[model samples]
Target: MPSSPPNPQLAKRYISYTVDDIARLFGIHRHTVREWIKRGLPVIDKQRPLLVQGADLAEFLRKRRDARKQSCAPGQLFCLRCRVPREPAGWQVVYRPLTATQGTLNGLCGTCSARMCRRVSLAKLTAAAGNLAITTTQAGEHIDECPTPIVNRDFKEG
Candidate 1:
């Protein structure tokens, strides 16, 4: 039978780690450690000389590290066109409150800013429709119609 060697990384230290220490060691917030304590995670010992087991800390740290590694970074937008990170060339940000009129913001980065804009064309606000071009009649009736542009195809017959 083969014998397994000891894991030097799991060495027990003679120091008492506070909630902060546990959080820092595990790369978690201090409040999380308190929550874990409240959630009844097993304590190694509650003896006169208080000490936490290295095994318990190691287990917690391993789980947290794995979760963090698997998660996506914050505020990362996936581009629909390229299927990667996107930087929108032109975008507008506006705060449309339920009880108030929309407020527009200036100088905000289009890539990272919120989307809220009245898309207008030819001196008129655009109304929602299926990819349509807008035109005003002589009698001032807004006709929502699509402009069918001619497509020229130079297909090489093989």
Candidate 2:
């Protein structure tokens, strides 16, 4: 008897994709993709960064792509700083790739880029807050200090 073929859904699903691919396919910014992953979205596995599976992209695109729309012309790039796509200009042509292997990134408006930077700094600040410790060292007394010496030996003079 002949065996059945594997389902197309299971036919060698992609193990990873770059942030640019996810952003282009899902109609969102690359930073948004990272942010979603950081927020504990089921799609992110973070064993490594800038690589997402086909399954994750499909799920995210299915959920979010329809709600957002763009009207950029062909060959235009989105600007993270301005939140719009425009033809590449002298100063607006910055290509910041997330991973070296992923190649160049689609540009965002200058404003969007600044916003992304701010968000990243804010995240670092929030992480630092989680590691904060309060100690009595500022009061000039050490908690580990004892009235008696920890190692005291009685030595008689010869």
TM-score to native of every candidate shown: 0.27, 0.27
**lDDT per residue as tens, model 2, 37-141:** 654335445565557677765564443333124434443444434434444432232222222222222232334342111111222332322222211122233
Cα lDDT over the full model 1: 0.33
The residue-by-residue lDDT of candidate 1 on 91-136, one tens digit each, is: 2222222212322111122355432122223222222211223222
Per-residue error (Å), model 1, residue 52: 2.3
Consecutive 10-residue window with the lowest summed lDDT within model 2: 149-158
Model 2 residue 25 distance off true place after TM-score fit, in angstroms: 3.1
Where does candidate 1 stray beyond 4 Å? 1-30, 39-41, 45-51, 71-158
- The number of clashing residue pairs in each candidate reads 0, 13
User: Clashes in model 1: which pairs?
Assistant: none
